[model samples]
Target: MSTLVAERQLVADACRVLAARGLADGFLGHVSLRVDDERLLVRCRGPQERGLRWTTPEDVHLVTLDGEPGDDGELGEWAPPNELPLHAEVLRTRPEVSAVVHAHPPAVVTADLAGLAVRPVVGAFDMPGTKLAAGGVPVYPRGVLVRDRRLAAEMVAAMGNRPVVLLRGHGLTSAGASVPEAVLHALSVDRLARLELAVVSAGGTLVDLPAEDMAELPDLGAGFNHATAWRHELANLP
Candidate 1:
């Protein structure tokens, strides 16, 4: 109905999509939507709520860029993720970013640990992979959890102008102007990571697309294929 309501629903849906796609594992990831220049709505989970697979709109909490609750007394028993600084600082610094997703996809973490580069091997068969290589995904090179501003600031610095950043042996952080865009980027990163690992494991030599070829691929404009993915995952939600 309202813009805020829509954004909140988007954030919730993004979490479900993350769970459905296996990008998140048992309460280990978070998604946030920028409500404005000063505030954002992020998925908050208590100890009892152990997974993102069943997250609903009620699980979404509103907090300021400084990581303060929208209504101090309203949060009640809900607690924001410890990595709030990751979302807060990114949204604060990147005005163009309206959504952020921090996820621990196994494929991504594995690839990083093996020192494998996620390249554009499949071309158009994988839109997200193509886009990632085109944009030059950066790695944060830190294996620790981003629980404070200093670490978060380092992550943001490593991210620079990139939409996605690999957190060494940790995970990944994806940002976009919308929930769909961010979610899709996260999914794409995982897909690319998986593909890279598969190739290496199979003893196949990996060949990346040339810079000129990468430029020829179309951008993932707007939400790209996120809407289609959302519908498919939503339909299958338990």
Candidate 2:
């Protein structure tokens, strides 16, 4: 298959994984892949539905680095996420990035409101099959919308080479060379966020992960492990 065609499927499949985990929540989050150096294929924003197992490549839209929806709009004629600005902005600023995944997982969002932060826990929060947010995922100070260019720039600056950025009072933003890699970063961010919550809950402090542990963290998947997480969320779906 062409790179573009494969990218569309990858993007769609990634969304299903997020929906299954209750991450996307209808239309709350978005996932995008850089099919070209200057363009991205992302989920079109429409109805906010969950448990998406039927998304097709047609559901993906090709957009520019400047956030302009592509010409052949019919590929996924649907409107892209309002946060497309954020995605496009990141891709423009970070040339190393090829995919971006933004999600509002409850645990991570709750941790943010609780004044919690993600820090290096195992050698910089590295885990097996997980893309540890190197340099740590810094939570943006509150009050900045995802589309705010200044805020997005600051977040990118903080992210540096790490794969994720935590937006205070909002959610998580992760980037990878491929869509799957980006998804891996997102999943790892959630896991680390959960770990931080657990540590604080037990009256423990979140200390930085030693360099050794950071080097040991695994790269499980590019946030593609939705089936496992989806099954767990089945009982909690409201």
Candidate 3:
């Protein structure tokens, strides 16, 4: 496939993966890829509007940073997602990032609202995720729809240099150099959230892995963490 075709496929598949994994409920979430300095390929709610689980490559639209469709007007009856700024601002601010995923994972929202921030609760459960949690996940205090530049800037400020940022009661925004990495970050964070809630609900206390064990965790590199894990997601998608 040509690069554009592949990118659209990636965006659509990312949404499908997120939906199948319980990260995005209904048709409210979006995934985006920086097409260049000025344009992007983002998931759009096409006329069929079957929601994320039913997303197909045709549902992806090529649009400018301002959320305008490409000259062909391929957008047709659909429009870019309302929270385009959430992805636009991130791509504009973080030059190294090429993809962004905004998802409303139920466990993530519930855990954050209950004041259970993801922590380094275990070393072996997920090495990369444990490291991410140990680095401190930042939370954006607002729950309002981030549909404007200013609100998105605020979210970026809270995100800082982290791979993921939680948007209070809303959801999370994850950034990465590729679509797979971005989606993986969301999956990892959500997994941590679910584990946190499960432990707490079972009346167990979260104990951080000892500093030495954390220090011993090896960096498995992107090949294993992103490519391999993403393959697993695709294989399991129904």
Candidate 4:
């Protein structure tokens, strides 16, 4: 397959993984990748509109960072997600980010509303996840549909240089260097949220991992953290 074809497949597969992992519901949520400085491969809604669970390559289309269709100038009846701007502005500003995953994991929303922030609370449960939480996750304090440039820009500004942003009363947006890494970030955060919920619901308190243990977490590199983990996600997909 050509590079474009590969990227489209990646986006579609990521969408399925999101739904399979319970991060998205119905036709909500999206996955996108920067194709170049000017264009990107994103999951658009086909005429069938079967939702993210049924996403396939045909559901993925090419659009510019400015939200225009590909060089073909048309995508027929297919329409990009209403939150296209959420993906566009991020790609426009973050040169280091090649992929973006926006998801609506229910536990994450609950955790945020209950004032449970995402912190490095576990030590050996997950290594990469622990490191990611240590870096801090910012929250975009709005639940509005980010369908315009101005709103999208605001979300990006709130996200800053962090790997993820918790959309208050809405969903979460996670960024990474590839399709798998981005999805993994969302998965890790969702796990943390679920744990927080379980702990709090059982009359426990949220606590961060000891500084000494956090300092000992190793940098396992992308090989094990992204590539290998991605294969596992794909393998587990129903």
Residue 20 displacement in candidate 1 (angstroms): 1.0
Better of 2 and 3 by TM-score: 3
**C-alpha-based local distance difference test score of model 1:** 0.83
The best-first sequence of candidates by lDDT reads 3, 4, 1, 2
| TM-score of every model versus the real structure | 0.91, 0.76, 0.97, 0.97
lDDT-wise, the better of 1 and 3 is 3
Q: Give the per-residue Cα lDDT of candidate 4 at 123.
A: 85
Model 3 Cα lDDT, one tens digit per residue, 1-62? 13488888989999999999999978889999998899999998788798999998888988
Cα deviation in Å at residue 130, candidate 4? Answer: 1.1
| Winner by lDDT between candidate 2 and candidate 1 | 1
lDDT of 3 at 15: 97
Q: State the C-alpha lDDT per candidate.
A: 0.83, 0.69, 0.92, 0.90
lDDT of 1 by residue, 1-238 (tens): 1236777787888898898889886778999998778888999976569688888777888888776877656466788889999999999889999999999899999988998876777777776657676678899988988989999999999999899999998889999988887887888888888988998999998888776877677755545476676666678766
What is the Å distance of residue 206 in model 4 from its true position? 1.0
Deviation from truth (RMSD, Å), model 2: 5.0
- Displacement of the residue 19 alpha carbon in candidate 1, Å: 1.1
